[model samples]
Target: MGGPDSLTKDTAHDVASHRIASVEGENGGGKEDAKDNALQALSTFLRDDMEACNREIVARMQSPVPLIPQLGAHLVAAGGKRLRPLLTLAAARLCGYEPSPERQRHVGLAACVEFIHTATLLHDDVVDESTLRRGLASANAVFGNKASVLVGDFLFARSFQLMTADGSLKVMAILSAASATIAEGEVLQMATQNDLSTPIERYLEVIHGKTAALFAAACRVGAVVAGRPEAEEAALEAYGTNLGMAFQLVDDALDYAADQQVLGKTVGDDMREGKITLPVLAAYQAGNEEDRAFWLRVIETGEQHDEDLPHALDLIARTGAIQTTLERAQSYARAAMQALDIFPESEIRQLLMDAASYTVSRVN
Candidate 1:
């Protein structure tokens, strides 16, 4: 939960400390403020489209089973930034797609994207045994794991219904493939959990399948609906993939470095769960024998004590793992920005680029 300054003192990694400071300072008021401004700008730009998407989301989530709607509304009302759905809507608009009364494919598809994301959150909470989400009690905690899992299944079914109604096999193919890849990623994560020896390449595979696939699918669907060229579709997909990577890397760093109040969930939850992230890998790779033994006891053997988290944080900070993680995230953010260069200059394009910058800048 400590900031860079709190974590950096008395450490020999001066260069990494300075790099962290410089990156945070470059965002002006703060990374959190910068991210807030970026999200607000995107939301305002896509207000009408988002409203339609919300309506579609509500309508599709309804069912005769009262518990379904109740559970779905609880999660929806928790009010995440809706970044996935927003990506779909924004990417569509950026490709010159407009919604009409008779044809609002983007809106429905945006809602569909949200359904998939929300379903994953429900399932993930159950799997991670998570109690909090978006600074509120998670659905699994409130509704029981059984209900949470069932509701997640319901949402997945609903997403497919929306996709089928869109009547585009290409759209269906992209989303369905993403859904499968997400499942595979979760399985892969489970396989690698509590194992300190998991390689960086394997970790990248996990994140790409779990997070980036949907991001890429969401953006590519936009180009598909607009009947854009394959080149443009590939470009947007690349942008989304890189942005998702940056976003997840920042999230991992924040688990070790962010204020708990700002982070919404418990700090070090990943460490507590013995999940091997980039920070852990970086720190372990740089640590000596004693440090390696410590990681083995806590992470591999699942034997943690009251002071273990602080020690882990110290190790991560002293090794400059958080800074290293953030720097890698910055590279992905830059790649995401470059992917958009093929598109001509426009307000939407700029907003998309800002969104990519915000992916790395966000502290929460």
Candidate 2:
């Protein structure tokens, strides 16, 4: 896998540590506490059900081939917050779906959402040639790409099986469309990857495909399982779509603005990979001829050097690229919160709203 230059492991580690210290000092208390509290509230609300979802994940990952289970488990056990699955469960409960042997099927459906997300991550690491995931070596980095890809396929297959087992054609249709959309989004991102001229519209399209589509699908499934009316279904989907957009925008900005530890990845990984995220697009479009030339050389031509990162960061900061990106994220977060208004007031509704704000707070 001959990719463009990337930071050495040691360099990224040191840079991340320094960024964490700086963020800790600058961000003192407020939003950080809110973010943690919101996530904790959601997690506490769904703890028992999430445990059941985990058990379902483990049961479904079984294959006669031990390597398949091992690789799948490795990725699954990695430190993701399981936000998508949580959305499914919470959305269902918010719709007043009562717990029963029948209602418990939501757990399996939530597990299916996790499998889809995990499969995508596995394939994404292969596509990106990524070495680290969730602060540890990626499965592809340790087990080899062939194993990762095949195991990812297995997971995708497993998810479809789980979807079918739930016996809801509505659920099946929503998740299947999302799966295809996610693939299309990955390919779209590939097409736009190194092109500095990639427009903001195209960038948003890519993220909607890659990130938000599944989020919408996940939440929509919850309402479906609850036998909620189509209006409620649309509301949850809207909530998820906006939340997903906000989440990705924050993520794109954090890749440039966050400390390595806080971000759980290298600061300039997107730039190094020539991925044209919002911040890069913002700075490039805002710059004069000289800045455009710099972007052309580094992003388009992949001629980045050590000094180029600082220069890029300087350009982004001076152009208020991160600030503008985060502002867009906040707008989406607000929209996400607004989407929940049609639902009755409940602790779950407030937590979901808080969850939207928490998604963008990393960049705040």
Candidate 3:
């Protein structure tokens, strides 16, 4: 495996641009279509397994209470990329595990990963007072915060049931610990909200727990199910962790820069909500005294006006915060690609590499 230094910025950009162009050529579409081309490719490659996993997800989401499934189905229909579960399935396959009647644990576990993610989205939307999710009305908006919270709890319970059904103490321990860490991450984010003085280390810790923990657990369980060696498990965990960090960093950048139509959510939601993400942090760190005062007014004091978002964007742009954040994401994506060096060359492995590239390319 190469070190992070092995993949320079130019190299990462060239590789990702080439991969994006390849997908665009194949699909006869533009760069817009290329954003999710890796996910589409992985979905096509794992169509059968993903179908089975979807079935398991639908089945487990059911409840006697009508609203449980209704709210769950609404979220499912909104069509998130399901990246974590895909990681689980892809990792299992990369480890040479095939689903069978007696050995179908991966499928259920994949569904379990989705359940956990969905539950988090529900709770997060409620906490953030978000009205939109994936360009659709948020569950909390449509179903009410109480209903969304209760249904999220229901999904968490269902996820646990699937974990118990898997009958692997190791799997249960991995996922359960991730769940706890996710909660702590959310709380930590809350603690840091509206506080511009939050350190970079604390911000990294929050994202590691909030986003990367489940990603690591999801990939690790795939190796566990395949009974692969501990080294392989650790490799996949590293890949997922770095991939997740890259993903979140790009997401934060997009919050300020992306087109709402393309981003599938309102731009500047983080800024409006006083969340101090990497872009904000970097901009604040680099800004002059007046710039610091601006961030203090809009973010720290939460006195944002309708025109404040544009000024914030200008500040971030002038300080090159968005570019810096994306570069940081590229480094993580490079590390993620290097992590997969332990695996032998194969179609699945190449697609996994492309997926890491896609994580950084998303901001392009």
Q: Would you list the clashing residue pairs of candidate 3?
A: none
lDDT of 1 by residue, 1-364 (tens): 1121232222313332333334333333433454557866777677778666766776676776766766765665466777898899989988998767899999999999999999999999999999899888898877789989998999999999999999999999999999999999999999999998999989989999889999999999999999899999999999999998888889899999999888999999999999989999999999999999999999999999999999999999999999999999999999999999989999899989999988888879
TM-score of each: 0.90, 0.89, 0.90
Q: Higher-TM-score candidate among 1 and 2?
A: 1
What TM value does model 1 have? 0.90
Candidate 2 Cα outliers beyond 4 Å, as residue runs = 1-35
Q: Could you tell me how far off, in angstroms, the CA of residue 129 lies in candidate 1 after the best superposition?
A: 0.5
lDDT of 3 by residue, 1-364 (tens): 1222334444434343444344334544433554467876776677668777876776676666666656665666576687899999999999999777876999999999989988999999999999889888887877789988998999999999999999999999999999999999999999999999999889988899899999999999999999999999999999999999999999999999999988988999999899979999999999999999999999999998999999999999999999999999999999999999999999899989999998888742
Candidate lDDT scores, in order, read 0.85, 0.84, 0.86
Judge candidate 2 at residue 95 and give its lDDT: 92
lDDT (0-100) at residue 255 of candidate 1?
95
Count of clashing pairs, candidate 3: 0
**Regions of candidate 3 where Cα sits further than 4 Å from its true position:** 1-36
Off by over 4 Å in 1: 1-36
lDDT of 2 by residue, 300-325 (tens): 99998999998999999999999999
lDDT of 2 at 106: 82
Per-candidate RMSD, Å: 11.0, 7.5, 10.8
Q: After superposition, how far is residue 273 of candidate 3 from its true place, in Å?
A: 1.0
Q: Per-residue error at 113 for model 3, in Å?
A: 0.5
